[model samples]
Target: MTLRHAAFAAAAAMLLMGPAHAAELEKLWEIDGLKQPESALYDASGGVIFVSEVVGDMRAKDGDGQISKVSPEGKVVQSGWVKGLNAPKGLGLSGGKLYAADIDELVEIDVASGKVTARHKVEGAVFLNDIVTDGAGRVYVSDSGTNTISVLESGEVKPWLRNDRLNSPNGLAIEGDAMVVASFGKPAAAGQEAVPGFLVEAPLSGDSVRTLGDGSPIGALDGLVVLGGGKYLATDYIKGGLLRIDQSGSFETLAPLPSGTADLSYDPQTKTAFVPQNKEGKLTAFRIP
Candidate 1:
């Protein structure tokens, strides 16, 4: 089989309700990692990088399952040691306060205090996947299990966009007054064709959902972020690579982010994108040309 067909087959396997470990991925970089390190973010002001080690071995770091901070020279370190979190998936930081979305709750941590200052309840949330903050400081959480988006305002948990039809909402992005989400379709069935995922544009003020590009062969569009100028950079789990989609739904292949990335972040000021894959356990950096 050709490379593209092989990737499609891999995605078909994923849709059939199998684990990510079931497939072998193309090597993106020469990096060795941990059990499942999901999402990553760039802290430009502090000159440090942060990534979520979702499920880790205590012998590797500590039992806290903290977010690792790697420096420019590849020196690895950690901060905000969150102890016994029920799988911290995606992380976001604003004004130096770190926000973590674990399966059960959204917790706020203050590095100065080294304590979880506040924790809020996410309603109808069976699994809280990704947590992100738009520049205005409003926090959004992708509750994948309930098919809803949870918003945090002034430290209070508020529900937003509850729609069951949204099958497997995997990633979050802000696009001109709406939340552009990538939906990976329902579980794959044996011998059934793998369902293709698409980018849906949902307004922030209300529930007006519209699909931008239908029948997207890229399949599982996970960990998306604005690439500036109304375009996006997304991780394609099925294809075992990264993808770039423009404003008009025109897309191009970005690069390889194999091992399935969870959440992605970019520093436009520096033109760098950080991809964190749970299965890869390695934080890889890509410079947008």
Candidate 2:
């Protein structure tokens, strides 16, 4: 056989194997002794990582939450880089500012000064979980309690989308003109058990929100990161694992983590993923294929 033919055959074999057998997470390092770290954000230009720590209860307005700064090498640069927050969960960076989902408000901090400049209140927000920013610098946050996604733009915070179909959205990611949501699934109703969550795609310009694939349950999903080529990496908050979900909504567990694997951050350029193990009080870094 010709060399080109052999290469094509090998590639076809890998495609047939699917992501389930092809993807594996290699552990790089872990930083322990965190205070219920819930989310991580990697700043490529700044060469650092930011972690939100819920020092106390997850739902309490105790004002003990803090953000930590860590080096790429797993060293804690500053344990309390920013404080005076009430259970901050998600972190996003844009326009030299850092935005965090703090319970019911969007907290904005100057990345250079590490000072919180503003806190935009979401009127009906119950438990704000994840935050993401688009290329235009507009910020979007998910309220898991209210099943809503709110947006902050032009100096105003308002509800962008609210629907029961969100099913307790916990993570947010921007993909072109659509927003990919990691649902935590709806809480159990009377005489009914809780339902496992699934990936949802909501159009940014329309009201159509639909399940990604066949409406099948994946897990109580949390963090969501777009890996391009119609692929995503998500963390299951309840099941405690990393998942590789395709555009068709089919998924395979990539890593079996501990419970409370909350909002994770992926640096595509470096091919690294940072996971905040909320229950274990640790931040782990893994090299991804």
Candidate 3:
């Protein structure tokens, strides 16, 4: 069989052997009064959740963006907890600092005082989408528009990986020595819809990138959370759904969500997921089984 046909065949086999039943998604509570909530991060030590909101145009460097604090039980404790940001999309917490992926820079905020302490600008960065820490005091941010991943190590910012095959990488998570990325897909035209995304595993020690599963399209994948045992929970940004995928690239639709399901935070303790519906301006909590 040709490469394309072989890929399709493998995908078909995966579909047949994937999970027969979808997980139960029980709605918990919803937080309203948010403007384009883009990402959610759970603070385990503080027992709170921090959400990023792009109050203005995502590409525009307007100072209307802000971050909010939500209680564990789904209350907006402080809507404007930290303000004066510009289109903050993703968030990461490391070493008592909350890092935000702003339009062209990574903004660092002091977690204790909730104050903007530093801003590390990425040279030639256009759209920095997702931010994550590798548990080693290193902050990694994905620049989708530039097709690059920038790293902040030892108080410096530099481009770590620049690969055109990334295809507008969005959500990111560190798995072992590799960085698993969820793509937003390549744009069809200057002002057209994306081509649908998939998952890719890129090794931190090398420049190689390998597609997960049969390399078939998943969706406009947004946020990604590793669910241990070689499984993951991902969000489809355009199609509007939550999905569970195994190591073999087999996927099962867990729940259908509204469009604009952005970055998500999953708490394994309670089997709960905090999802941000940006266009709907709502933050919802769902129990996943």
Name the best candidate (by TM-score). 2
lDDT: worst 10-residue window of model 2: 17-26
Q: Write the per-residue lDDT of candidate 2 for residues 40-91, one digit (tens) a residue.
A: 9999899999999999999999989999999988999999999999999999
- Candidate 1's displacement at residue 117, Å, is 1.5
In TM-score terms, candidate 2 sits at 0.91
Report the lDDT tens digits of candidate 3 across residue range 132-251.
897789999999898899999999999888897788989999989899999889756788866888888899874888887777888888999998889999998888888887877788
Q: Show where candidate 3 strays beyond 4 Å.
A: 1-23, 190-193
Flag the better candidate by TM-score, 1 or 3: 3
lDDT measured at residue 22 in model 3 versus the true structure, 0 to 100? 50
* Candidate 2: residue pairs that collide: none
Better of 1 and 3 by lDDT: 3
Which residue pairs of candidate 1 clash? 15-188, 33-281, 34-281, 36-278, 37-278
**Greater-TM-score candidate between 1 and 2:** 2
Ranking by TM-score: 2, 3, 1
TM-score against native, each model: 0.79, 0.91, 0.90
